[model samples]
Target: MFNSAVATLNAPPVSIVLNWKSSYDGANGALIDMSQAVPGYSAHPDILAALAKGASDPALARYGPVEGDPEFRSAYADHVSQLYNAKIDRNEVQITSGCNQAFVATVLALAGHGDRILMMRPCYFNHESTLGMLGVGIDYVDCDDDGGLLPNCASIDAAIGPQTRAIALVSPNNPAGSIYPAPLLADILALCQKRGIWLILDETYRDFMPLDMDVPHHLFAQDDWQSSLIQLYSFSKSYCLPGHRLGAIIAGHDVVAQLAKVIDNIQICAPRVAQHALTPMLTSMSSWRQENRERIAARATVFRTAMDDLPGWDLLSSGAYFGYVRHPFTGVGSRQLAETMARKAGVLVIPGAFFGAGQDGALRFAFANAGRDVIVKLADRLSSLTL
Candidate 1:
């Protein structure tokens, strides 16, 4: 009566965390939620105005092209090309319902039931779950070390087997928030090119990178980079429009065409109203997005400072939107500690085990959504934990 594969999946991570948050209602203190990575800010007023206008436009009520709204495709491509200083065209980009959908479509197009995808350990759990349900082999290459969450070229090279079809990675990584250095990305890209395997780079948090960091990586500038690189992006974080569910993929024109078939069967096209609303803001709202980036950076700084003085906990990595910390408890698993924090301290965070194996002692805090005062209060609550 139901899909057995779906039954094997765990409950969604964010929802579980949200449930924990709900347990603290009317408690002694404010509940500080650091579970899900979502923008704390609202969409720009101008973007909101555009969305209202788009909603009222009767033309958008009809079905849109399966690929995307032509206006959105063109606008997004131009925006990406200008940001990366690369040669990108509308034909090379495909808009999807969200980054998750973009990833799903790419996986379906690139790998079959038994084929493998190399994922960095401490992966975004949704990616792992998606591959599991598809019966695609997930070969995890551990990125955790004294050096942090950056990919090791040697480890990544050794993980590739004949069945491996691609290497998937997320930067300003979801659980740890470690931004891979550009040189390391170059090395990984070269290795993929040599092996004739695809590099699926999920740059969902690219817009939140430090203002001084300028560009995320130089892979886009390489000759024929599209042959080895498939980049995924989300407008949700940058534009504060997660509810709109807009995301995209940038690849070779040929690959985009292949994605069209998978996407057509999935959602036909991304939401039309948001696509129409976002097309103009891609260029017009650049400065507003930059301000949001700075705001998140400030939050990251506050979290780092709060963790620095903690007696037992260790801040393993902090950037973009997350802070991965090793909990003080020696015997307790991460899930238990997370629950304890929620029920006892009114602070909610995701257990590290949700991200990958061998991570039972750590927890990931999505600190971007919490402001400085909330973060300070969170630190006080965490400090009060006896274990």
Candidate 2:
């Protein structure tokens, strides 16, 4: 009785991974779950305290502005402006329930069924699923073997067809964890501008960039940047507030106005409690968030070292919270291997096939969820795998 898009879509990755958990019987310390890229630690006490205060405020219990709390719009605008070193205004921001919603709303606003959205190979699976349900066509901008699907102007030009409406990219990308370079990002944006297509950038992991590479890109500094750019962000990762379901969209006033309609119809408004809670702490919590970034980066180093010693495993690309690994078995599909790994080795990872096609032999390690010591144990488990 379901629609073709929903029926044709693959099984949910998390559900598939969780199913494997039942067979797990490894004698190792405990299950080392590297599945979801959630925060490894608790939200900062200050944030929790703020949340409590916001929850206690009866004024926030009622419905909020569909455009979002005006105070948060202004705060997030200022946050992005200072963070990206670009001039921004509150009018450009629209709060959403999560970055996923930000993406869905933006995608619906810009394109319709049969319209094309150009994306990178081995993309975040949810983006693919969302487009599929909407009956939108997906075209690819291929990435190299090194990890990131950084598209040059020529590649992007070749990928664009008559139906292509936008190019969507995720940096510190999900599944692969490749961070796109600044110059390359600028070039792609320029191409999108020339083509008169929107460039939808999802920077959910921007906070976790390595210290030397703090700023992810410089697109916002360009003249008339908003006309061609639609940026998506998440306070969930940065603030450890995923349960709060808070995210934002950065676009021109016209785009924000359009998004208001989408948000009004879908969510009416993002969760009001979290919006009120975070409004006061957005600027104040930067140093704390920076400390968490450093911690995650350090965990990345531990994960990298562990992968290096594994006989058959190859680390393809790693950044932020994820590592895309090429498993040793040549002919085995990733789904079967992932299941076996979960059962025998007591390790949990998502098979690469869930991300996109031709990804049968790879796996995505959401390594940031595990601490340094747990990451070290990953090497031990894989080393013991007989396959």
Which digits, one per residue and each the tens of the lDDT, describe model 1 over residues 1-387?
668778889999888877876566536487888888899879989999999998999999888988899989999999988888787888888999999999999999899988999999888999999998888999988876587977789999999999999999999898889999999999999999999999999999999898799888889899999899999999899988898899999999889989999998998888999999998899999899889899999999989988987878899988999999998898899988898788888888999999989889899999998888888876678778754
lDDT at 270, model 1: 88
- Residues 278-353, candidate 2: write the lDDT tens digits: 9978888888988999999999999999999998898889999899999999999999999889988999999998
Computed on alpha carbons, the lDDT of every model, listed in order, comes to 0.90, 0.90
Candidate 2's C-alpha runs over 4 A off are 147-149
- Write out the backbone clash pairs for model 2: none
lDDT minimum window of 10 residues, candidate 1: 19-28
| Model 2 global lDDT (CA atoms, 0 to 1) | 0.90
TM values, all candidates:
0.98, 0.98
TM-score for candidate 1, residues paired by index:
0.98
lDDT of 2 at 115: 99
